[model samples]
Target chain A: MEQLVSALLIMIIGVLACAAYFYASNWLLDVLFPSKNKPADIVAKNIHITNTVRPWLFIGPALIALTFYLIYPVIESIRLSFLGRAGEEFVGFDNYAWLFSSDTFYQSFKNNMLWLIVVPTASTFFGLIIATMTDKIWWGNIAKSLIFMPMAISFIGASVIWKFIYDFRSGDDAQIGLLNAIVVFFGGEPQAWITVPFWNNLFLMIILIWIQTGFAMVILSAALRGIPSETIEAAVLDGANSIQIFFKIMVPQIWGTIAVVWTTITILVLKVFDIVLAMTNGQWGTQVLANEMFDWMFRGGGDFGRGAVVAIVIMVLVIPIMVWNIKDVNKEMEGR
Target chain B: MMAVSSSRSSLMWVVHITVFILVVMWTVPTAGLFISSIRDKDQLSVSGWWTALSVSEQRLVARSEHPDKQVFSSDGRYEIRGNILEHQDSSITKFGSSSLRPDEFDVGVVAQLKGGKTLQVLENGDYIYSSPEQWKGKRGKRIFYTANIPPRFTLDNYREVLTSEGLAKSFINSLAVTIPATIIPILMAAFAAYALAWMKFPGRALIIAAVVGLLVVPLQMSLIPLLKTYNLIGEFFGVGSKGYIGIWLAHTGFGLPLAIYLLRNYIAGLPGEIIESARVDGANDFEIFSKIILPLSFPALASFAIFQFLWVWNDLLIAMVFLGNNEEQLVLTGRLRELLGSRGGNWEILTASAFVTIIIPLCVFFGLQRYLVRGLLSGSVK
Candidate 1:
């Protein structure tokens, strides 16, 4: 209770402080250059000066935060990749050599690749299918909401939920988990789904697919709605079947949205950590790059060099997407 | 035409059935978690939550009254009578005197014991033990029974987690981290977004492009370097490296790119006349932004608020890095991860904790789904 009270106090103070900064800074600017009751030329100069400086005042805090937290970190992480464990000595490329030869890094890279290929494609596929199907049904909104419901669940919570489903028991005891029960009912032996070598990565991917499919669905559904009805009518009149109309006309038109969803989920897959950490914890060949980087960061009293190398690996993977995003935004800005 | 119509109707039915199956597949996992959270812990461990509404059978053992309590009856037999269920809401379907054959005799059927004693069990859990003379033993007989237990639900799991497992405290911590983290970014991003959108500034296009580029930079790139920086600052200031203030700033920084981008797009799209006319009325840029743009951009502000709230609330990696794992500062996700490690097999604790962690976000998602969906549509497609 006391902690909660302090937290509330901190929240109120922090917010008030932010409000005070903006208000105080603006007030100071107006006080320093009073445009009213001055010569016309002086007034014009004061207004121009305020206009020039006011924009800086507005953007100052945000710029400091971004540079300190994000931009600086990217640069520092690169420099640290060349240093030693404690970052005291400069060991050139030793961490990179260790990362390249390490079998676990290869395993994590392989698994991350699998995730990159599977999660986005599967999520986009399911999302497009559900969006198209739900658009036709009367109860589609409810179905859409139900499917999207998992998006609210944290990765740890989702891990717990999936872990329960994948639980296993030896001997003749009843199979309490849903998956094992089904397997047992089908006269098959129950297997620990998350412990299997290659198959376990797929099992881990399923959780992400489940959470992200709804995102794909919502975006694609809107894109589908944006498609002109005349195209679909044209296809129907020309004797194209429903599947043909969907694949030929609708899918082709909404291809850009599909790519967007795919890239978004792909970027998310590159940063996947909590799910892997909670379930299997890089054990059983389920290691991914993000989790691997996290393990290196704090493993055995921390190794900043190796950790930065892994982060650089993740950053390298994301460069293409970053460039693509900047180009897309530039185009949009140009159009505007 | 008639054949095509018939086939079209059939296809529609196929779509409905497929969608129905997909919905059930998506919803059942969460529904199962909720059901298991409320189920009796013993039953929850023994049976799947899908069978929560059905009668479950279990092998259980109970002791009869001491033989010394046997007394002479009107039928000329020493007898002992009692209910083996001890007021439990279950019925015995079968019973035996030995562990080897626990369900040896059907309910209401008499089974012969050693020394010419007999025992009869009834479905309602009543048992009668009788002998030709007096039964002799230092302790009561061990009677094993197979019980048919009805479905049971309770709030005990939730109560236990809330009170004992430190979830209540973590819930408060999550709120503390989330509220400030959500609000600070919105304020900072809104100011910057307004400047970029309305106010003419040097290098505005460059800053906008930087924000866009930062949007997809993997957060893994930021963790280690930031940790070192925070440690340095902590040493310099004589404060701990990890705390709510550190985490709130981290979340605000990470969330700012999307917040600025979304808000900038919305604010830029506002009719230019509002700001122009206000400027012509001799209002300063600050007054124009505070009075006109802020009110007009409520929808955009709302969307970003929901996004940041959910992201901060659901984040575990950021919390694990920026905040300490001690009980005083652990947020719900961190707490849930700890519980997963410490009590992996204890579903009672896990389901309840997981539910507690997700309930708030679920409520927020459902309650503000309109803004959430709107935000996603604009953020992604545009």
Candidate 2:
């Protein structure tokens, strides 16, 4: 209880301190360059100076934080990739060589490729189908919300939920888990789902796909709504079936939005570490780049060199999407 | 949508059925966890949650009364009588004296024992043992029965996890991390968003573009360098590297780009005349912001708050990296992961703990999901 109270106190103080800084700093800026009740020329000069300075005042703290946390880290990580474990000595390309030569790194890379191919495509496909079907139904909102509920659950929580489903009991213990129960009900042997080598990767991917389908659905549902009714109406009048109208007219129009949802889930799949970490911790041939990176970060009192190399690999994969996102935003901003 | 053909109506049935199956598929996992959390711990391991509603059959062993409790009947025969079931709600279906065939005799049947002793068991669990001579055994006879136990539910798992599993502490820690992390980013991002939107400053376009790029940078890229920076700062300041303040700042830094982007999109879409009129009325940027822009952008701010709150609350990687794993600082997700590692097979503990960690977000998601969806629609760059 005392700890809670102290935490509450700290929270209030922290927030209030940020508020105070913004207010006080802006107030100081106004005080330092007073434009009121001054000579007209001096007032104009003060207005110009404050116009330039006050925006900075509003933006200063955010800029400093973004630079320190994000921009500088990107550069420092790239530099550390070329350095030694403690990051004090330079080891040019040694970490990269080791990363390529290691069996575990190869396994992680292959698994990551599998995840990249499976998670996004499956999620996007299910999302599109569910979105289209649900829009035609009356209870669509309830279905959408239920599907979207998994998005709110943490990866660890979802792992636990799915783990309970995949739980195994040996030697005719009535098969408590739902999966094994069903398997035994159908006269099949119960297998340890997460321990299988190649197939277990698909099992793990199912959890992610289940969690992400809702996100894709929501976004794609919105995009489906954005489709012009006239086009669909025309398609229907042209003797087109529902499927034809959907694929031929509606989906093509929302291709951009579909791409957006696809890329978003793709980015998420790349950064997915918690599910694997909590579920298997890269065991059973289920390693991925992000989890492997996390492993190296703390494996032997912190191997900063190899960890940064893995991070750079993730960055390289993300660069195309990053470039595309910026260009899309720039194009949209210009239209605005 | 209104002009569907009659043939499509049959297809609509297919759609409804398919959607029903999909909804059940999505909802049953969570529903199972919720039901399991409230079930009797003994029944939970033996039956699936789908069967939680019906009576569960169990093989239970009970002991008959000892010979000291025997009474002399009117005919001078010794008899012992007692109820086997502790709870009257359960009914015994079959009984036996050995473990090999626990259901050797049907209820209400009399089974003859050695030495002219006969035992009769009833469905309601009442049993009678009769002997012609005086009963001499000190110990009671062991009787096994296949009993139909009623469905039972309790909140004991929740109580145990909350009180003893350290979830109660982690709940508070999650709040302490989430609330400030949620609020601080809103304040900082609202100001920055306002600047990027209304104020015509140099390089504003570049900054906006940069924010978009940063949106996709994998957090793995930042972990090592940030930890190094934290360690250095901690060395200089004589504090632990992993602390709440450090994590709060970290969440804020990560969340700011989205916050700014979402708010900027909304704020820029607001009627520009309001800010212009306020400016013409001799109001400064600060005045126009606090009184006008802030109130008008409440939906965006709220949506971002919900996002940041859920993100910080549900985050495990950040919590594991940025905060200590001790009871003082472990968030719910971290604690749940630890529990998953240690008590991997204990379903009651895992289910209860996982439900506790997810319950708040589920509530918030259900309550403010409209704003969340709206935020996502606008937050994603078209």
Candidate 3:
């Protein structure tokens, strides 16, 4: 309790310090410039100085934090990838060589590719289906909220929930897990679902798909609603069936939002760590890039070089999406 | 047209059925977790939560009172009589004397024992033992029975986990990390977002593009480097490398891009006239930001707050890297992962702890779902 109190106090102080910086620095800028009281030429010069300096003052703290936390780390990680385990001595391409030759890296890379292909496509497909179905129902909001509830659950929490579903019992013991119970009910052999080698990767991906489908649903639902009504009406008048209207008219219009949702879930699938860490921990052939990177960072003492190499793999995969996002934003800015 | 109308009606039925199935599919897993958390641990382990309301048969054992409590009846026979279940509300269905065949006899049957002894069991869990000579033993006979136990539910699992599993402390730790991490980023990002939005800056477009690019930079890229830097800073400051302050700062830095991006879009959309007139009224940029723009941008701030709050609260990777895994600093997710590793089979502990971990976010998700959905739409669709 005392610790909590002290932490809260520190938080308040930190927030207050941030507020004071913004306030005091802006005040200091005005005092230094004296834009209102100076002679005409001097006033113009001071105004220009304040305008140029004030924007920096507003952005300075954020810039410093971003550079320290993000930009510098990206550069440092590249450098660390070239160094040895302790990161003190340079090892050139040794880390990359080991990474390329290791079976685990290949396994992780393959699993990551599989996840990238399956999770986003599955989530977006389900999201579009649910969005279309729920739009016509009166209780649609309630259904959407229920489906979306998993979005709030942490990946680890979702893992626990799904683990319970995939639980297995050997012999004649009653199958307490829902999946095995259904399997037994259908007169089939109940298998330990997550320990099934190559197939277990799909089980892990299901957890992510379950959590992310709601995000896709919410975004795609909004996009579906934003579709102009006249096009659908015109399709109906032209003897286009409901499915035809959905495919030919509505889908093409919201293709942009669908791509957005797809990429968003794709990025998420790349960074998925907690689910694999909690559920399988890269065991049972469920290894992925993010969890593998984490494993190397602390597996035996620490391997900075190997960890950074794996991180760079994930970063390389994200560059395309990153470039695409920047282009999208640049286009938006130009429009503005 | 008439045939199309009929087909459409049938399609509506299909939609309703499909939606119903989907909703159940999505909700049952969480609902199962909740139900299992409240169920009796014994029943929860042996049976699915779907059978939580049904009578579950269990094999149980009881011993009669010690032979010292035996009495000589009027018929000149020694007997020991007792209720096996004591005060439980279960009925015995079968009884036996050995572990190999625990259901060897019917509830009302009499089984003859060696040396002129007899035993009889009843459905009400009452058993009788009689001997022609005397029952001379320190312990009574063991009676095994299959009882039909009705469904039971309790808060004992929750109580045990909250008090014994260190979750209560981790809950506080999570709040400590989350609340400030949520607030500080919003405060810093609001200023940066405003400058990028309303203020005429030379590099605004370039910075906006950078924020967008950084949004997708995998956190894996930052963990190793940041860990080294944090250790150095901690050495210089003479504090541990992992602490609440370090984690709060890390979360703030990580969450700033999205906060800035979301808030910039929203703040940039505010009417030019409002800010122009405010500026024309001699209101300084700080004054305008704190007074007019801040209050007006409440929705955007709220949207970002919920996002950051959920992100920081649910985060395990950042917490694991920045805060370390010491008990004093473990967040709920980390604690839960540990519980999963240690008590992999103890569903009672896992379910209850998971419920405790997820309940707060569930409440926030339901209560402020409007803002969350709006945030998602703006963050992605825009």
Candidate 4:
């Protein structure tokens, strides 16, 4: 009861404090830097809206929001990573050392690697196929929309709809779980589909694929449609068959788009939590780093240190990809 | 022939057929959900909805007082003069009324009983009974009638689902989280993106790189740590640790880097001419962004909003972390997830909940979808 009350108290006070801080910062800015540009244009010279100050003003609320929610947590996680389960006592590099020495963490890291490789590739591949095939059809837009419909469903929702598909019921009076019913019809034993470990990950991957294929298709479709018609015609005149044209002309032309599609799916795969939570809850060797963190923190009686280490590791893995993506964008820009 | 002007014109039919097949393939599961939501629960159990339009033979149990009890008499025996044609008045359809004489009747005729009783039945549940004696005994026995019911449709399923299902509350919860989650990120991202795109500063590249670097940092990686941070700060400031504001901030933080990246790319790609001209006209960055860049970059804004809206609306993890699981605070996604375990087989509730969750997204998507143009990149690329 005291905990709940104190938490509430903290929320109200934190908000008020943050507000006060912002106001104080603004005042400090006013006192610290007086503009020397009285001769400036009306738009630029507005004392309240200088180009230098305005951007920060625009950026201020967002920065505070991120700081409390994201940046602070990232810092705190690093601090907590070395702490024990009590969270009061500090243990230096123990969590980091545990990660290198621990088999469980290693296995989880391996599984995540497999998921990252498999999910993005499959989604992107299917997306490319759908995009290319539909691009030629007259009702392409409608077809694309149908495939994209699953994208509207939350990950949890998709997991549910897929659950019925993968459902296994013990041989009951009717074998009502759909997939098991089919297996029964074929005179096979019903299996607990989600408990099947690596195979279950594939099942989870299907849900991601179902939702994301449309995203991949849509972006790639837009890029496909954007290809200059004359370029394709010219390729055809040069004795390229349909397959050759697709491979040589189309693929090369849309490389930037393909890269974008791949990267976006990669980003989504990194944060995948809902499907795992909804379906397997990261049990039976299907645990990814993200869901594992939740297990350690919330489910496993709040192991903040290990959870933080996993988070830091994820950040390390993802930051480089983000940098690579940025570099790719810069290159795409420079190439253009 | 004009048709021969196209060598494979005949194959156009083939192409159309193939495309139609694919469309049907894509549409079947969705169609199944729609049909399952409305179909009678009993019928839904016995057969798939593809048979919804066909007459279904259903065994309807009814009261069958002895036919003699169904009749009324004016005179005693020898009242067989009137057959099933003129007696009681109620219409009965393709199903014969009696189990013993299941096939004893024809299209529109009734039959006479041995005890000078007459019964008439029509195809529409109208029936008449006449007998030489007064009726006696309670409803005789339970009668089974195999009635061929024509296809029936009702809004009752939806009514039951939306009202009693608790989906309505969850739908609102989802929106509460979603609306703020959607708004805060775009608001932040737009400003950050503009700064990154237009504002000159030291370490601009580094800041963007940091943000981009932040992009891959999975929220799961930071989930526990973030919660701890919130708790600590909440402690100092008297805030407990979790709430809507916390979730919104989390969503905004998670959403910010991408929003910044996407919007910056788009804003940066804007014809430099416009920003340059605005600058020359002495317009500051905000005015130029608000007046010139925003309107021109509608496609980007719409796309990003769609992505962010759908994402936050569908988010479960952040909601689980920052927001308490209390009924009032539980978002739609979380609620739907809970329902998946408890009410998994209740197709009506599941479909209705899904539709409720998706309603806003569909609205947002179709609404802004038009702004997703073909060639926003054309001017930028060239």
Per-candidate fnat, comma-separated: 0.87, 0.79, 0.78, 0.46
Candidate 3 C-alpha lDDT tens digits along A1-336: 786787678778877887789899999988988868669999889878887888888888888888888999999999999999999999999999999999999999999999999999999999999999999999999999999999999988999999999999998889999999999999999999999998999999899989989999999999999999999999988989888999999999999999999999999999989999998899999999999999999988999999999999999999999999999889988997
For A1-336, candidate 2 gives per-residue lDDT tens digits of 998899899999999999999899879978988889999998889888888888998988888889988999999999999999999999999999999999999999999999999999999999999999999999999999999999999998999999888989888677778888899999999989899889989988999999999999999999899888999998878989888998999899989888888898999999989989987899999999999999999997999999999999999999999999899889988987
**In model 3, what lDDT does residue B165 have?**
97
Q: What is the lDDT of residue B225 in candidate 3?
A: 98
Candidate no. 1 TM-score: 0.97
Once superposed on the true structure, which residue ranges of model 1 sit more than 4 Å away at CA? B65-81, B115-118, B128-141
The order by descending TM-score is 3, 1, 2, 4
C-alpha DockQ of every model: 0.88, 0.80, 0.79, 0.32
- Give the alpha carbon lDDT tens digit for every residue of A242-288 in model 4: 67888888989989778777776787787787888888777887888
Q: Which ranges of candidate 2 are over 4 A from the true structure?
A: A334-336, B1-5, B62-86, B108-121, B126-143
Task: Return whichever of 1 and 2 wins on lDDT.
Answer: 1
TM-score for chain B of all predictions: 0.93, 0.89, 0.96, 0.74
Residue B231 of model 1 has an lDDT of: 97
Clashing pairs in 3: none
Candidate 4 global lDDT: 0.68
Whole-model lDDT values for every prediction: 0.93, 0.92, 0.92, 0.68
Model 4 interface CAPRI class: acceptable
What 10-residue stretch in candidate 3 chain A is worst by lDDT?
A: A6-15
Q: How many clashing pairs in candidate 1?
A: 0
Q: How many backbone clashes does candidate 2 have?
A: 0
